[model samples]
Target: MALLSDGHFHSGETIAQQVGLSRTAVAGHISQLSDWGLDVFKVKGKGYRLERGFSLLNAESIKKHLGNTKRAMIDVESVLPSTNTEMKKRIANARHELADGDAIFAEIQTAGRGRHGRTWLAPIGGSLTFSMYWSFPDGYQSMAGLSLMVGLAVCEALKDFGVDDAELKWPNDIYLQGKKLAGILIEVEGQIGATAHSVIGIGLNVCVPDSQYDVGQPHSDLTSYLGHTPDRNSLAAAIIKSLWTLLPKFTQQGFGPFAPHWEALDLYADKRIVLQMGEKRFSGIDRGVDASGALLVETQDGITRFHGGEVSLRGNR
Candidate 1:
């Protein structure tokens, strides 16, 4: 798989010889790659190649970009059901050795998830799918605005990588020209009075191919704006580093310092919008988010605050 990851075709006989596998066995492996959402192209005599050339995530490259930070344990997986799930299992097993800033990156996620039980579609090498474990001394209630802070971190990281137009959409989405470029899911497990542990999952589209997959909403990838794909390792490192730097301040100062920046990058601020909670809906003008990161919407009747869980927002359109 690494050999063909360069997006060039290699003959099955050559691949078999290189991997010391029978040609028939190699064919079986190729078939399984499709199940991982990797687009493998097989030509009559040329052998197999990826639909496009992409570099696999390199942990060292990510660390190098991170630079002189706390010793962050980085795990890179070629395929996983979900990085968030993997991190949770580790925590469940009482892996106390795992500290804040530890992260996992997956090349392809077969069962990646989003808010509202949506499937997170991450084609191999087409998107950045990863999760980081962050711990706060404060309890879960004190982390009310944490997701909004993370959204700001993502926007700052995108700007660092020369992606200037990325904007924040309410609670946990980053958008480019109103199309979603990234989404975030935060899951925490901790007792009421104890320190909170959050598994922050992020899925940022990098180079999704034009295909028939229904994403269920307008979406955009970095390739659409940058005219070329950015290195996944570099992008991942930027995001991780940004979050690492921000988490401590967030724990200390809460969301106050980040409020101005969040509003600056807000996609729907002061615009007509709709908020949905289950079957209930409210239309209002976006007043941006409050100090606690609850969305502030000024409806015809009065102002309403909507938190992250079980709520969705849409533009007037």
Candidate 2:
């Protein structure tokens, strides 16, 4: 796999010799790569190569980019069922090693998930899927708009990477020209009166291949805008750096400081949209979000504030 990762073709005999495997075994391994969402191109005599190539995640590169100021335990895995699930388990058993800013990254997730019980499909080496564990001194009540603040941090990181047009959809989605570019799912665990811990899971499409599975929504990747694929390790490091800086501010000021920035990047601001809350729906013009980050919508009757739980927003389609 490392030899083919260079985006160049390698003969079957050469690959077999390098890996000390029979040619038949090598062929079987190549076939399994296709099942893992990689585009393997095989020719009659030219051997095999990845269609768009791949860049394996490097933990050391990521840590170097993060530098000295960012204090977090970073773990990288080639495969996992879900980063969030893994982080939660670590928190439960290895709480001594974990801290407020610990994070985990996975190259591929076999059972990734999103908000509302939706499956998140992240191809191997194609997307950035990671989870960060954060602890807040305040209780759950004071964490009203933490997700919105995290979205702001992601948008800021994207801007730093030259993706300036990314916008924030209400609740926890990042859109590029109406197509989904990224999504966030935050899971919290704690008692009502004690400190709260949040597992922030983020999935961003970087260079995903065409999939047979239906994502059920329009989507776009970073390569579509950047003209080339960015290194996943570097991008992850940038995002972590941004989060490290933004979280302290959020802990001090709550969501009030981030409200204006979020509104400026809001894709549905001043636009007609529908808010789906289970079986019921409400149509209104988006008036941006209030200081508390609850979406403010102006319906036919009057203005109302809607919180994030079980609520999904979409533009008129």
lDDT tens digits by residue: candidate 2, 95-136? 456777788999878889999889998977779999999887
Native-to-model Cα distance after best TM-score fit, residue 231 in candidate 2, in Å: 2.1
Candidate 1 lDDT (Cα, 0 to 1): 0.88
lDDT of 2: 0.87
- Residue 306 of model 1, lDDT score: 86
lDDT of 1 by residue, 260-300 (tens): 88999989989999888888888999998888998989987
lDDT of 2 at 33: 76
Q: lDDT of each model, Cα atoms only?
A: 0.88, 0.87
Q: Which candidate should be chosen as best, given TM-score against the real structure?
A: 1
Relative to the true structure, candidate 1 has a C-alpha RMSD (angstroms) of: 1.4
TM-scores vs. true structure, each candidate: 0.96, 0.91
Candidate 2 weakest lDDT stretch, 10 residues: 207-216
